[model samples]
Target: MENRIDFVNWLDPDMSIQILTCLDDLSDLLRVTCVSRCWRQYVIANGLCRQLCLRMFPQLSKVVHVVEQRYGTKDPAEVGSSNFMEWQNLEREHRAYAFLARGCTTFPIRDLISEPICASSTDNYPEESIDNTLEPRDVVAQRASYWSSKGNSNPAEPEMLLYKLMGDLCVITEVSIQPFEAYFQWGLPIYSAKAVRFRMGHPKSPVDVPLGESYKDYENKFIWTYTSQEFPMAQENRLQTFKLPEPVLCIGGFLLIELLGRVQRQDMDGLFYIWFAPSSLFNCSFLVFMVNCCELFQDQCASTLIEYFVILAIIFSHNVYVTDQL
Candidate 1:
């Protein structure tokens, strides 16, 4: 009987890399690393993960340069070591991409908000409390139950929402907002802002300042890290996603959402509404493979579907439980 030769071992290293490059799934790529020492070495040597990350998020190219610059001036002895410099560079890229992937892959929605944060607006009705929009839930009785500011005479004055993330550091890629639609009304008027802006940073002092001092006072003290471009908001009640021009590395945890312009309700008596839900505020991480797949098929299909069912499955299997509170 002839001995069977392992194709992977026989194949040229470059050919193996080319074959592996076709795999877009991060999990699958990670699995390949565990197949054998040869496979692992080949994958690491070529910096497959780093390449995949860069392919997914071109913005990561900037990060790669920053990393290179930080570690460039190594000792001559270290540099002279056989493939040591190459290996080190690849490892650094792998780590950076892994960190970015963690932020984008699985979003802990429940853990997103650090505390019971509220917007700087008066709650008009108890039913339409701001807290209602914090989590995903079915529409309650088809009523416009959402947080609304008191009737503002001048719509130009901006209304703001202040909140903090669960983590001190966050790489923000996208922000989603949903305006409240008064479906119960005749025309189903959607209360939305003409424009929206975001600011992220850390406060100079502890944010536990007295309430009477005002949020504006605390906001003025914050050292902003990034300010997003003013995105035009559509006057639609449904959830709308707005992708930032670039990813923002927010060192500080605080986030401020500014709603601009006055949208009047034709049904309501001259009252301007800035109605929104806490559920509307979504900070989406950019998943490279999913996004690329979507774009690839976008022109062929009427709609693109990029579902993170893994996240949902995990949540259902672990986080959810039957309670006896009833």
Candidate 2:
């Protein structure tokens, strides 16, 4: 009877889907699917299961740029349909609104600065293109021309955003207080952020401050000697905040490109790092589901494909639990 009860519990697909959909725990559902072929088939065939999966697959727009940076492709043509364009704009506005909800009155300074620099008013291509009179190459050139006009006007390279900000010593000092991956390695890919810190200026007094002194004692001694108006307490704190080597920032851009280059290499597997915290992981999963639902405003994909991938990703994440139990 105990074995019978265990068999019934293990065989339950409705219960698996319920936990996945209700708890929003894809990892657990995924684990169950990996347990046997039956659960996988049931998930694939169920309408509600498909709907849930479709709702989770589109939360990848931010990382889309990173993928392109790694792979050297523009946004896919399929993702640029009129409906998808509207959806993309809507998502941006919605994100802005959500940030506003959390008291972020301003968006990232980079976005604000880049807008007019890279702005274009062009929408979907001409009806003639849709009607197939223009050759594919012509259509590509026309689209490129539209974007080129906007980007060429005072033409901003993306790297310029970082380089211009790099020498601004005052701003670098401010970033030191925050340990976010951005402040330490602005141009590096997100995963290479471990132990990175911000640095700004040289150590004072023409000799190294020994590592033996407590931070407070070092500060007190520096404050007394560097009394010159040029390097006051505030300036000392700013300079002291420099933790990571400044030279790393110089190599950051090239390192990013190199990391992308090695991504497909087998030996490079050791270099990949998982930096997502539990909260961030949960939030991303939720966003994927939300984007899937809100995607109706843009290029539409069949709900079935969305369902397929989301469920699969969720199942794969269950390896975490299986490993933990062992």
Candidate 3:
């Protein structure tokens, strides 16, 4: 052991951090902690594990800080926690990041919408219901099927479609929308929005907003925790996908699709209506073989940082969830 070189001791702190961060695998980082007490202290003290986790999943940036739910009996101010408190907190974060990064494998892509909650408006009740969007094909039972917002003279009057996920937590990656092509109407115009945005979160209250024909009372319904940047839509008769910048773990099960800047107008009515046909809100899921994320649910460590994505796959396997690739 005399001839062995100590990188943490001999190298500059910044250089040492850079070298350790270069390690791409979780096993490589875990080995660094096992090398010696100095290496372990340096690794945890500098927060190499949390840094790597953020590097891998930029979505974790939303989490401002980590606080253990269980606290000491005495206040930290009364008993100095500069050494022990900080060290234990660092270890907790280290363990969390390490567990989240472990055993990542390919997961099947699927739809996360449990059910359609409501639409801002409807052109013709029962005929143009939000439920029609669930059907993949534009034509259902030999008839054109689509959800159409009320013809608004003001194109600026944006429309919204709300949906619920299968679980309380969902890791959302992509959302796909298809503008409806009106074949029955003259010249066959595609009713599409200039841009679209997606929002995900949980409802503020236990009581759900009233759901019925063309419900518009969305105010104070939910607390949106995550909102994606506006994605410009196309006036075509095909599916358009807007993948999120990164995989976002949505704490709440609710999602809202806001259609902005309508571009189509009914020739007869002279009003714009954002028509949607089988808009697939695809949930890009993840699977973890090594880490039992279910256990993290029990520990309650996942509420702030990440949640189990395997829930999406479970819904798919049950054969209730239908996701159309097109």
The most accurate candidate by lDDT is 3
lDDT of 2 by residue, 232-277 (tens): 1121111112222111211001000000111111123323221111
Off by over 4 Å in 2: 4-16, 47-50, 53-326
lDDT score, residue 253, model 1? 66
Q: Give lDDT tens digits, candidate 3, residues 142-194.
A: 78989888888898889888887765545677777888899899999999999
Error of 2 at 173 (Å): 24
C-alpha lDDT (0 to 100) for residue 228 of candidate 1: 81
What is candidate 1's lDDT per residue for 14-67, written digit by digit as tens? 787788989876888878878888777777778888777667544344331423
| TM-score for each model | 0.52, 0.20, 0.70
Name the 10 consecutive residues with the lowest summed lDDT in model 1: 308-317
**Reference-based lDDT, each prediction:** 0.60, 0.22, 0.70
Estimate candidate 2's alpha-carbon lDDT, on a 0 to 1 scale.
0.22
List the candidates ranked by lDDT, beginning with the highest.
3, 1, 2
RMSD of candidate 1 to the truth, in angstroms, is 14.0
TM-score quality measure for candidate 1: 0.52
Off by over 4 Å in 1: 1-111, 138-144, 209-214, 286-326
